[model samples]
Target: MFRLKTMIGLFAGALMLTAGISQASATELRIASGFGDNHSATRALREVFARKVEELTDGRYTVSVFPNSELGQATEMVNQAQSGINFGVYVSSAFYNSQVPELGVTNLPFVFPDRETAFKVFDGPFGDKFKPLFEKSGLVVLGYMELGFRNVTNSVRKIAEPADLKGLKIRLQNNPVHIATFRQLGANPVSIDGSEMFAALSQGVVDAQENPYSVINAFRLYDAGQKYMSDTGHFFDVIVFAGSKSMLDAMSAEDRQAILNAGRLATEAQRKFAKEDEAADLKSILSHGVTFTRLTPEEREDFRKATLPVYDLVRERLGAGLVDEFLADVDAAK
Candidate 1:
């Protein structure tokens, strides 16, 4: 009986040692996003991206997702990822423009005629040229996901022409190119953070704002008294999925490859979700009694023409050579 009790004690001790080793072998990567939980990008990150990473890594790696600015605002979250406080971040391309001003080339109004042309440019040589810029800022480009084309929403009136936007105070992202584009169209552009947008609209701090249908619906901007929406499609926005270079470098090659593969899959899935959700999101927004306007080709051309000097403004800010190359690339892609 004494021998048997000693053997049982030894067995239990071995089991505890094994459990500790198993726990220590697993690594948890935290990914942060400014988008709300309901946003398709957030959903893709949680469902497709996180799941694939765990599966591909054979449970050696796990992901923790914090959405809706739980980690921090978009730019702050990007800083966390850069510093390795968070393992990765999914943020707007516009947010990265401060660090890589060349990225502003992508934010130029009407640069991409449609989604297909945009994808071709980003997935090909143009993207190859820009990826290094992001890497220099301590990020490894995982993949680019679609944020979709931006549309105008307002409490004031329907926007069918450039003159219709005259004197309207529109909330815009803190991007110089975007602000310049709106200013060219005769609206007063106010830079407000995403978290404050609904309140700003509701309280009349701004009469108008621009975002994709997904954002307006997810944030319920209609409830904020925004009764007019126009399919401006001014800028084809992109969401960049990036990992910390420092943190990724610390990982084994096999582990790093697993993360990259997961990111690619997640980005593809996210783009699909964004495209699929747009029509439904628009229908939902219209159901809220928001007036909608779909600009004809001629009307869109007028807005595009009014903002033409923005291209020159971009050239002045980002250099004519780079902007010219980008335009050539965009034209070639088409």
Candidate 2:
């Protein structure tokens, strides 16, 4: 009986050693985003990428996701990825304008007629042009996740024309292009972070804000006294899924391929989720008693014209005529 017990102890020790080796062999990656844990982007990363990457890499790699800006703000997360610390971040193309101003081209108002056109452009050759731009800033562009078309929400009134937005204190992301566009439309656009948006809207710190329907619903902004929503669809938001270039470069070819494949899967999942959530989100917001307005074609055109000077503003900051050339190319391709 004593000899049998000793043999069992030896077997348990060997099993423990094997488990330790297996755990140490897997490379764990950290992915962070500002979206809530239940947000589609977070779900895609956790469900689609995290679950598949290990299998895709034959158990060589795994992922951990941090949502709700737990890792840091979007800008801080981008900086972490740039430093090659095995970090991935879901940020906006508008945020990239700070690192590479020309990337702001993707954020231009009314650039794409609709989400379908925007996705085709981003998934095609046009999106390829920005890869090197991202690499130059120490990031590997994994995929472009959809944020959908941003619209306007305010407590003041329904915004049907450019004049309707005048003098309203609106909260916008800290993107210069966005600030300039809103300034042109005559609203007082204040740059603020996402985490502070709910309070800003609730406390009268800002009377208006703009974001995708999903985002507006996710943060429960409608409950914060925002009474009106207009489907301006001014800027089609693109969430950039990215990783540290150096870390990606250091990986073996097979591992890199696995990462890319996982990213593609995550992007597909996010886009699908965004599409499905939009209508549901809008419905939920309506249930909160917020009035909705679908912009008439002429009213949308008024916004388009009002913000046209933003192209020149972008040109002056990025380079002369870059915006015009980019838009022309996109139009010709379409």
Candidate 3:
């Protein structure tokens, strides 16, 4: 009986040791985004990125995603990721412009005439230039996802030409290039946080706003009294997937690779989803009795010409030489 009891004690100790080892091998990571949970980018992060990370890491790592600003607003979340408070962030590239001013080149009006050209530039050398800048800021650029082309929406009337936008109060992101573009187009660009955009529009704080179809649909901005939408395609926005450099550096090589691989897969999935859903989102928006304006080539050209000075503003902020290189690269990609 004494021998049997000793054997049982040994067995229990071994089992406890194995359980502890298993627990220690598993890691949990947190990813944050300011987009709504239903947004395609958030969905891609949760469904594809997070899942792929777990699978690629053989269940050794798990990711928890906090969407809809549960972690904080876009800029705050960026700070958290920089400080390693969060493992990663998926937010607008515009949000990173403050940290890497050269990144604002992507936000230049009408730089990308279509999604194909935008993807080529971003996935090519032009996009590669910003990786080191992000690294200098203690962040890793995992991948760039599509936020699609930004369009103008207003409660007052259809913006068929640049002159139509004159004197209208428009809510815009806190992006200098965006603000300058609208200002040059003769609209009163009011910088508003994304969280406050709906209220500002609904309560008449702003008469107009611009965003991609995905954001418009996800936020249900149509319900906020926006009665008109035009395909301005002023800016083709990109959502960046960035990881905390310190956190990633601390991770094992295999684990870091797993995260990067997951980022690539998620980015591809998101771009596809956003492109496919654009038409559906537009249809849904118009179903709410919103008038839609499809600008003719001449009309688009007029708006584009009016916003051309925005390029000069960009060159001033980010040197004429670099801007020239970027524009040349854009042309080559096209």
Q: What is the lDDT of candidate 3?
A: 0.90
Give the per-residue lDDT digits (tens) of candidate 1, residues 1-334.
9999999999999999987887688898999987899888888989998999999988888899998889878889889999999999888787887667888898999889998899898999888788888788999989989999999999989999999999999999888999999999999999987878899999999999999999999999999999999999999999988999998899889989999999999989999999899999999999999999999999999999999999999999999999999899899989
Candidate 1's C-alpha runs over 4 A off are 1-21
Between candidates 1 and 2, the lDDT winner: 1
Ranking by TM-score: 1, 2, 3
Q: What are the per-residue Cα lDDT tens digits for candidate 3 across 220-263?
A: 99999999999999999999889999989998999899999999
lDDT values for all models: 0.91, 0.87, 0.90
Per-candidate TM-scores read: 0.94, 0.93, 0.93
Q: Answer with 2 or 3, whichever has the higher lDDT.
A: 3
lDDT of 2 by residue, 141-230 (tens): 888999889999999999899999999999998898889889999999998888889999999999999999888999999888899999
Per-residue error for 55 in candidate 2, Å, reads 1.3
Determine which window of 10 residues in candidate 3 has minimal summed lDDT. Answer: 19-28
lDDT of 2: 0.87
Residue 4 accuracy (lDDT) in model 3: 100
> Which pairs clash (backbone N, Cα, C closer than 3 Å) in model 1?
none
